[model samples]
Target: MIRIACLIVMMMAGMLRAEVDARPDARVAARDAAQRLDAAARQMDKATTAKDRVKALSETVHAYEDGLDAMRDGLRRATVQEQRISRELKAREIEISRLLGVLQSIGAAPAPATLLHPDGPVGTARAGMVLADIMPGVNSEAASLRAQFEEVTTLRLLQKSATETLQKGLVGAQEARTALSQAVADRTDLPRRFTADPVRTAILIASTETLEGFASGLSQITDAEGGAPLPDISHRQGTLPLPVQGQVLRRAGEADAAGIQRPGIVMATRPQALVTTPTAATIRYRGPLLDYGNVMILEPQTGLLLVLAGLDVVYGHAGEVLPAGAPVGLMAGDPALSGEILQETPAGMGIGSGNRRSETLYIEIRQDNTPVDPELWFETDKDD
Candidate 1:
């Protein structure tokens, strides 16, 4: 029975790990966020306008927010595990009563004699019957004791790690939030694009009935100011670079788990990976969109636009002429395998979390507001 129970625990543990293998690691997340803060600081140093400064600080704020959120979740999950262990310890105390009684009476002559009896027919038969009745209780008590010790140790370690992460996140978030506030307060150095009529653009975005209409409206607003230098990207067909390094999980028109088929490529990438432009492009719009997280729309030519979405942070704003390979943003992820589930499992994992997010990027190329296969313009050798 002891062996069987141990086997059950082992199987359960494996299943838990399997489901959470996609979880971002805590330490890795902390480290990645710290690195991102440095990058944002550098960008802030070079920012000449209020919009640019705000863009840099926005990255910092996003990194801090993600880190703080992950740390809080980790701490919360660890506390729940500690509570569960406490409950198990209490249950074990009740379960061991019979085993404890047997142990106390082991010094009695009959019990000891029967347990230590030689293998003769009569003695062996009597001993076997007594052992059968006692072994299960004894084995169960031992298994529970072993499991309790291990559980306590694991909980303690998890709590300690979470505490450290929380401390780091708190410090980072505070500093970044302060800097972001200061950056936003500066209105004297606002850029021309930021000074543009935002109400009309907002109205256009709000009134657009479809993505094509929205893109077309954006193009009207983004029309090159008569003499702005185009990036000459129209010639780079069937060989444009990938925006970020990742494995292609889905091609254009592939139906996803949500049953929505769209003209885009979905790529699974590592946590906090750097997202960049494949060619020099003009930032038409970069910000949050409904259900897409952070999205960036960049135009490399007059009628063509590249759309990249599902990021933790975006680095540029509208009207910025981004050079090829310029960093656009960073994706979500951490180095550790941590699960964030919206509902509780049988084992009580993710009992109080809000949602689970998968790190998959969606890329779409639009030619004059019409969706087209991105593979035709991207390097075939690169993640084809």
Candidate 2:
């Protein structure tokens, strides 16, 4: 009976030792899983390309989930072990109480020799020894369980870190997508057609006025004498002058089917192109007139009316004399006929008017309030 009791005690002690030794392995496995998960999350953060980032994030999420599941499974197993150990400890405790009760009834001390009592056969003796051995085993198992719990908690913290990192990567990817989409939209181009006929007409009309003569004429008009001296008309006799040159999409007379009457001239250039003018002869005016969207009239001298229209910016003052080729302002196509001009010469001259494709310049030469065809005054074959 004593031998059997010794064998049972040895077996219980072995079970307790095995449980305690296994705890370190569980902790090591949990730590390894956390390391893998953290590494995957970091890789996801470094990915820059769209496809690569997507792949990396997917891998990272999978790793985190897998690690979390592994940790949960380990915790579950540990909990089951804990419960089993607790139940075994309780059963042993109840058996010990029964033994104590038997000793009390017999009026004897609860001692190891109680196993030798008449009712205590070999089985009872072995059971008493097993209970005693299991007590130390239960204590060791409790300590190991506490360590495993701590390891599981650490794993949870690592999982949270990985989850946050993954979320940040997703946000960054979304922002990049938005930025790229906007960039493409902003760079898109619009359809535009260049009408060479209008451009040629604008250039031709701009070349008819001489900058030197205009400047000289303006100076004479602003003099204090009320009537200024005229320049030597002989010097300007044969030279082809630069007329209204900036940008003339429409002429100064007549209207087509669109009810859009032509303006004197239109200009669309930068401020640098404007001519220098004397302050005394600068004139400023603004109002709706004919085909001109906004008109500015600057009469530098008597009998000379300088009209500026379709302007986005005007710097001339009233009574100021601006030189020729000065930048007046910008002109857009008319809203009525989309800024288009008809090109056709009048019928009485030798040149057939119908042969001309389009007449963009609507020029009229006026001498002392009487209007005349500009073609008769201007040399037609001059360089455009």
Candidate 3:
């Protein structure tokens, strides 16, 4: 038991060390993205041609979006981890209580001398049996105690890492928010490549009822002129990042809040969390769709459409090009902190609704109007 405890302790320590080592490099990347965003903002302001200004705007938007997305992802991993750590700690408490009860039942006084050195045959047999049974229970409890202690130690290590990560994310977000605001304000006009064609407005406005129909019809229109370079999204299949950082609550074909299943994934995340793009895509539509709040649809290629819904506020509009990791919107949040937030969910709508799991993002990947699992596109950890 001691050897097992030591082995587990070593493993947990190594995991924490990996987290610490990886942090500095991530910080550097975030800093570089922020710097590039600032430079792009300046470039956008100085450019004389509409094409030059649009190119600068794209770079600026991408940088700001990437930085903000990274910061928000870090914050969410840290924040949501606090709840998991809290659960481990609670289990540790239960184990400790059971061990304490066992110890209490053993009593504070030593065994009587008469029982320990019984002279009669019957007395000796009874004493021997009692000792044997009691010794095993004591040993078992001791081993259990040791294991629980190791578990608690590992949880503490994770808690400390999460706290530090949360701090860094919050700090980075503060700085990025300022720079992002400036970069976005610098964007006044759409480049000719991103401009909306007047001929398609009537057709687009007429087909807002179904996401599949809207995506298909919208794709048939030309949002851009033949000037700007666009990404080949099909090749980025295994390389795209998740638009948001959270655990997947449901996958394609799973039932949702309304007891109706859809071809999408429901993500559980922190309230007011920022959402971004997984890859370079052009906005096809952004508006309300029935019971779902603010929705944004993006087309990476001619046939595949990425649908993101359940946002409180959306940023970019239809026909605008969004680079990878570009900010699209933020989730709705209560003013209270995580601990203070209450659950007032309706029946069947509370799949991932807990004290901290306050927001949900619904994601769907459609290829030529057919639904596909989004899990295959983004990298995921074993725990997730």
Candidate 4:
């Protein structure tokens, strides 16, 4: 019965260890993300046209971002698991010491003495039965301890190697960003709905103080009365992707930190993150306006407008018709250095935190010059 109880405990310990090992491998995820970055880099190199280069570089940037995110997450898990294993080992220190001593003693005993007892055959038979039952439990514990030590070693190595991985990703992302900016500047293939009148635009800006007033008067900036109709994405209402990668900071009509409210959605994005047009649209205006930093006003369809603000650099010109996923702008803020990222991100491993996404992109949808909630048109849950 004592032997049976020891066997059961051994089985339970094995099961618990298996449960701990069932978690997804962090290193594997990081490796896969790195491969994606490699592929994107090759694609960027092979690009022939300005548009293709822009697309490829955009993909490369995304790949590096994903790889870095994976790296951070992997390091965090490794650190946590290493700490946990250390604690477990420390807690069982005395038990393991006693176990080693017992094993040493068993090995040192003579073969005959190990199997026999002074009381003779009956006593020896009882002693043999106890040893058989307890040996399995002892062996299982020793194996578990060995595994924990090996895992700790691996986790430490992972953390040490992460710095190099992070540095490479940061350099790759920056290069891609530089190439993307040049590509956008050289791009001239997009169709034009109409050329903007800078004098009229200046007049409109001088006349309007509010976004509503400016939007309502946008038609006066250009003389084109009925430009080519844009693709109708009316059926895609409530399913359009956000212009940039980010989480929704505030929904339409939600008051901000100062209790000021606006009929637009605020998205928190990483510094220098690429902003693409969700659908093919004609640019109406691009530049600073009112209190908004830098804004891009797009007309997706007649009577329907999409306003994206808070960009550091707005791409394309007013009246240029862009296809879906075209480079529109970049969110304001410099990319965090790789060293800073490694030092600051261990405590906050997620990309949704303010430390990761320091820039904000404000989006608003207007129909016939009336502001409407952006959530009604965009797929906000994609970030979640």
| Clashes per candidate, residues 3 or more apart or on different chains | 4, 32, 0, 0
Cα lDDT of candidate 3 equals 0.57
lDDT of 1 by residue, 1-384 (tens): 324433434434433344235333434443454455455444444453455665565555555545545555555655565556566556656444544454555535475564555667777677577556655555554565666567667665665655555555555545554565565455244222322246666787778766567677885554335445565666778877787765688888889899989898888765555577888787777777656888888888877999998987777567766667766777776523223322345543333542233478899999877899999888745453
Candidate 2 local accuracy as lDDT? 0.38
Alpha-carbon shift of residue 97 in model 3 (angstroms): 16
lDDT of 2 by residue, 1-384 (tens): 334433434444555456545544433444555555556456545533444343333334334434433443343343334444454455556433443353354346456554554665876767667656654544444454455445445544443443344343334333433333333233223211111233433343344263223322333333233234323232332343323323334334545668755433322322212222211233423333345444455443344444444443344333333344333332333222211112232311111111111213233333333433333333344234
- Provide TM-scores for the models: 0.48, 0.25, 0.52, 0.86
The number of the candidate with the highest lDDT is 4
In Å, residue 188's CA in model 4 sits off its true spot by 2.0
Off by over 4 Å in 1: 1-95, 107-147, 153-157, 160-171, 174-209, 217-280, 285-296, 307-317, 323-350, 354-364, 373-384
Error of 1 at 185 (Å): 8.0
Is 3 or 4 the stronger prediction by lDDT?
A: 4
Q: What is the C-alpha lDDT profile of model 3 across 230-340, one tens digit per residue?
A: 555666665677777667788778886688888788887665566788777778777776567888888787667889999887777667777667677767775233323
Please report, in order, the local distance difference test score of every candidate based on alpha carbons. 0.62, 0.38, 0.57, 0.77
Q: Determine which window of 10 residues in candidate 4 has minimal summed lDDT.
A: 346-355
- Cα shift from native, residue 225, model 3 (Å): 3.4
- Superposed model 3: Cα runs more than 4 Å off: 1-182, 188-192, 197-203, 220-224, 339-355, 381-384
Q: Give candidate 2 misplaced runs (Cα > 4 Å).
A: 1-255, 259-291, 298-301, 332-366, 374-384
